[model samples]
Target: MTRVEINFDGIVGPSHNYSGLSLGNIASTTNKGMVAYPRAAALEGVAKMRHNLALGLPQGILLPHPRPNRDWLDALGTRPDDVPETLRPAAFSASAMWAANAATVSPAPDTGDGRCHITVANLRTMPHRSHEWPATLRQLELAFADTRHFAVHPPVPPAFGDEGAANHMRLAAGHDAPGVEIFVYGLRGGAFPARQHVEASRAVARLNRLDPDRTLFVAQSEAAIAAGAFHNDVVAVANGHVLFAHEQAFEDRPAFYAALKRLLPELEIVEVPASVVSLEDAIRSYLFNAQLVTLPDGTMALIVPGEARETPSVWAWLEAMAAGNGPIRRLGVVDVRQSMANGGGPACLRLRVVADPATVDPRFLVDESKLDRIADCIASEWPEQIAPPDLGDPALWARIEQARRALHALLELDALL
Candidate 1:
């Protein structure tokens, strides 16, 4: 019954490539059509998991969804060979590696039934990701199959467009305590489509049976959305009682802050002003995309992508914050440039689930040995690199399938297939 926050990261798939599938994500678009290093990318993902373990945090992993997703392509009445050039990337998208979009979780402490509830996200916005729910749901059911302690639900009707935890935040004095669950939704983002709809947020809150009094639905800033902050996590992240964010992250910051303060009296708001770090700069550097975590020693740390350090203003502000007597006591920089280039950073690469480790499937959890095994698989089987054109090559498709199968056998998770 000891509930703790576990970061479940998605292992980068063998088909990791830069097809530029995500529209609103600036990094993904900027690097579209560029060559991608699948081997190095998967290894980077595993290394990030190792880094989390070294910090004394429990780390879990979700296996990569099968690539060249034959089933989905077959359903389209066209094979990978005959599929339109525009839709080819959808068959081999590695976007599922950003586990933040996996699901919306409500821990037992905050739910009426006293069991953690997880609802898979139906990523209906983009064609490449819309088909991910079935595979993602399979993994969720397998990982949280212990019905005595967990309740797993399928995605809400895709009509509502829910992007999952990337648009959600929970705050409380401690992990086990009942907290305020804030769901950030968007109405419009100018040229970019707002992925999380208000109705979808409401559906998830109700499905989890969260207390009406403790939940709040906030709007993401249209400005942030237009500036390539596709999800709210791109501009904000919450850990325990602290809400670390950019000043322009929300549509109505003052009202949201007032409401949050009322719910959690000790709430600390660490807002980086626009004068210091503009929204463009924040999105470009992925400064707010960092993981805000509580270390075993009870001190808070920000696990940021190496790009944050490269941005002069971001690094300076972070240094000043860590140097001061702030709630965030340390900075842990990690190199996930491969993921960063594809619009995912430390936070994007993880799904935060608060649950007892004993309740989760053992196969999904990892240690040093397991990480070593995963890294070995990636090094051996994953392709050295993938250009946009390589996705259509039958040989590369076969290799990708072989790599995933090797991992399935290695982890004894073939049932997930």
Candidate 2:
């Protein structure tokens, strides 16, 4: 049984814009209402995926939800003509481009029934994003419809406010070995609301039937979230058995890892102390958000956004970490400034699934040929730039529609049509 983990990255949509929809995210607030280049954004995202493939990493693609989601607008009891003029732009949001929020997946190795379970998130914390689950569920059901191998579960009830994989992480001895599952949540986290409810994290574990003894629940630092760590991924990320994080990321950092080590003695804890780099620097440079990928040769590489290079402290730390006798021996930096400006880093654009590629729906996978077709479509039809005011232009809707149709044609995903 060959075990593999695939990263299904979300394509930056044609409707990409900076509406400042997310409240607690610093980059979203800072670059709100600015002009966004959708073509360049999507191309950069494709290039990142291509880079991963060149490194012998497994990669997949998830399409963005159709824009101007009339289904969502209709669900709220408002027709296009009668909807409030001020709120119309919400219908065209491209927030689904951030794939990490799509769902939290538990692989077959840890489940009692031996079937992977995917809990689609009900992003209830923000009104702008709350309407997404209904549509997100439709896609999840389509992509993972094989009940024998996959069990796609509905979201935890709306009141709990689940944000999916961004708030959850799994660490195992091997891809197939049943190891520890870590659920990180925040409570009364300063001015910004804690997006991941503790109950939601517990519910996902319960839904998947994970072993309680191996599961660890930890609280995210109130200070971290207030300092712009809106989600755990903003301050920490996990890959395989290694946990890379900041010193102030957790409330009691030592205890969290100690308990994890008790469960799996090989658990590697890499913490960047605040004395070395401030929390503000971590958030600004998105140092903690780097994608920690284990390549084919078994050595690890840190895939980071170019912003990291500009920060002297972060750049020096990464250089030393890669050059020294550490698990991460390489650093791959690429430009994704378009997504970065909108509060998404390299990790934000990808969703990780642990399973054999043969078990997943073939429609959801990607290759070099498909990447070229998607990039060609983006270059030919995607709008060069989108401003906040442009969201209201009726002409913009037609271009968006055409762009999506072209992509759907290339990916052979007719479910959207």
Candidate 3:
């Protein structure tokens, strides 16, 4: 059987602090004003990337729209014409207001066929509260008629403080299989009552009656960290054997090593460093607006912010495989200037639709020795090609042009996605 993988796009939401909403409030927020514009633009870039990766079709699902608080556009000086056509409706919808800030979607694996499927989470909202279900499974069934397995978890009660379960359900439901696995974490609703927990457990047990092996139990980790704070810890379990981090590991050095020892007492723990951990912090920061997409050639691509943070905003494409980190390959980077005037990074600008391993030669992977030469070539020649307009301050324009060039070079790399 082909291995299944899960990729996450970072958080997305409205910028309540923008001037359009703030009105009389003079205090400037950290991600206020033009900053919010780039965030939106980055999301657009992600969508475009998703479209490209899916071979010009929708493959994966997009998370729930973020609620940046009403009047965020006003605070940012965003007018009706400023918003993209696809996002304009979402910006005003009530669903956008009450739903959890993020959701998950998936694209069909490229099995050589051009047909694809996409799944999205269903969100419900009441007067003052909101609730989530594994509703996306139902949607997946509808979207993909050939779906193999179906998984269902008991409905989770609404929690004013914690929305992680809801988000997880959305992601999990995007699976395209028929075998369903339900994981019970806690009480259905309200406070974690003892009786409620017992009832939930019983319900989960009853569901497993259909197929115990197919219906697996997953323990919710209290220590689960946010995608914003760290790179996701990927664990693959099958036939009683667990695979940590697919073929290699990312940033979970000390803790993950120990956890592996305990989880696989009889197995050897191997240390494999990440090939593309460079600019990880920057990548995480950018993920808030975009996602990393692996192309058919195994290259990875993400959009980055252009301004605000200490780093410059540009679309970053890397050839991790070329660096011999893992099966994933990196090509280069692409810089895009946000028309909205918001400073955006690679992650903020794009979404992923499809991620299929290519059948072509692996020789496309870049050699480590050649990386610096490539970077230097792009860094030096980029400025002359995309010169900044004279309207902006000379120095500021120069900096913007430089960032744009860097991004262009990154994107220009063959098979870089």
Candidate 4:
């Protein structure tokens, strides 16, 4: 039983564009109405998946949910025929490209039932993203349907406001070992609304059947959230026993570390002082959102965004960190600027699930061969670029729909209706 954490990156959807939909997401608001190259975005994503494969890391992919999700509009009692211009184009938003918000997964080792548990996020914070829960739930149910190995649960009731893995972090002795689960919540953060509710985090822990003793609830700092750390991942991320975070990431910094050390003595806490890396810089470059993975060689690597390489402070920090002879000795930078413009980074674009690949739906698994085919699909069928104004054009929808159909055929996924 070889256990590994497989990254399932969301294929950037054709309707990918900037609408300034997310209120607290600075990038999304700043770059709204800009031209987004959907074709390039997917190609870049596939290349990243292939990069991991070349490193002998197991990877997986998640298909974009059918977009211009008119069905949801119908459910919301909005007539598609006469949708107001402001909300009309927003309907075609492809924000689902950020799969990290897809679910909060608790591996089999930590769950009471001895089965991997996945709970989809309601994503009720932003209007453009609120309708994504149903599609996300459907995908989770389809991809992890093996009852013998996995358990898929719905989002905690709507009133609780759970933002999924973006607000959750799991630290374990190893991929296959049980360890502490940290549920970070923002009680009330300045003018910018706090996305993760304390109740929401508790609900997920209870629903996932996580042992209370092994779980810890931490408060997200008010300053951090207002500084564009809308989700905890924007400020903190944990891999194995290591937690890499900014100094201002939590309410009581020293106390959080002391408590974690008390509970999990093996914990390796890496604190980046505010002087070294300001919260604003961290949010802009998404340094904390980098995917930190333990390679097969028993050392870790930070899969960062290309933007980090351009930022002097972040790049300097990476160089120093890699040179310090720490367990994290490698850096892999990838270009995901299109997704980044919409307030997501390399880590934001993926959902990490630790389990045997054979236990998941084969269509969701990625191998070298599958990566090649996905690249081919992107080059041949995906749109070159998508602008905000293009969303209202009927032909754009047709092309987007056809591109997904081609991808389904290539991957042998079930056809979308």
For each candidate in the order shown, give its overall lDDT on alpha carbons: 0.93, 0.86, 0.29, 0.87
Top model number, lDDT: 1
lDDT of 3 at 239: 12
**lDDT order of candidates, best first?**
1, 4, 2, 3
Q: State the displacement of the C-alpha of residue 357, model 3, in Å, after optimal TM-score superposition.
A: 16
How does each model score on TM-score?
A: 0.99, 0.97, 0.36, 0.97
Error of 2 at 246 (Å): 0.3
Cα lDDT of model 3 by residue, 339-375, tens digit: 2122223332222222232311222112233333434
Quantify how close model 1 is to the true structure by its C-alpha RMSD in Å. 0.8
Worst 10 residues of 4 by lDDT: 80-89
| Count of backbone collisions in candidate 3 | 66
RMSDs, each prediction?
0.8, 1.2, 14.3, 1.3
Q: Give the TM-score of candidate 3.
A: 0.36
Candidate 4 lDDT tens digits, 1-417: 777999999999877887888888899899988888999888888888888887888888888877778787777778756666777655788888889999899999999998989999988877788888888888788889899888999998888788899999999888899979999999777778899989989999988999999999999999998998989999899999999899999998888888889888999987788998788889999999899998988888988999889888888998999999676889999888888988999999899999889888988898888788888888998889887887777788789889888888888875543
Q: Native-vs-model 4 lDDT?
A: 0.87
Runs of candidate 3 with Cα error greater than 4 angstroms are: 1-29, 32-47, 54-155, 159-255, 258-280, 287-294, 297-326, 331-417
Please give, for residues 1-417, the per-residue lDDT of candidate 1 as tens digits: 788999999989999999888999999999999999989999999999999999999999998998988898889888666877777799899989999999999999999999999999999999999999999999999999999888999999988999999999999999999999999999789999999999999999999999999999999999999999999999999999999999999999999999999999999999999999999989988998999999988999999999999999999999999999889989999999999999999999999999999989999999999999999888999999999998778899899999999999999999987
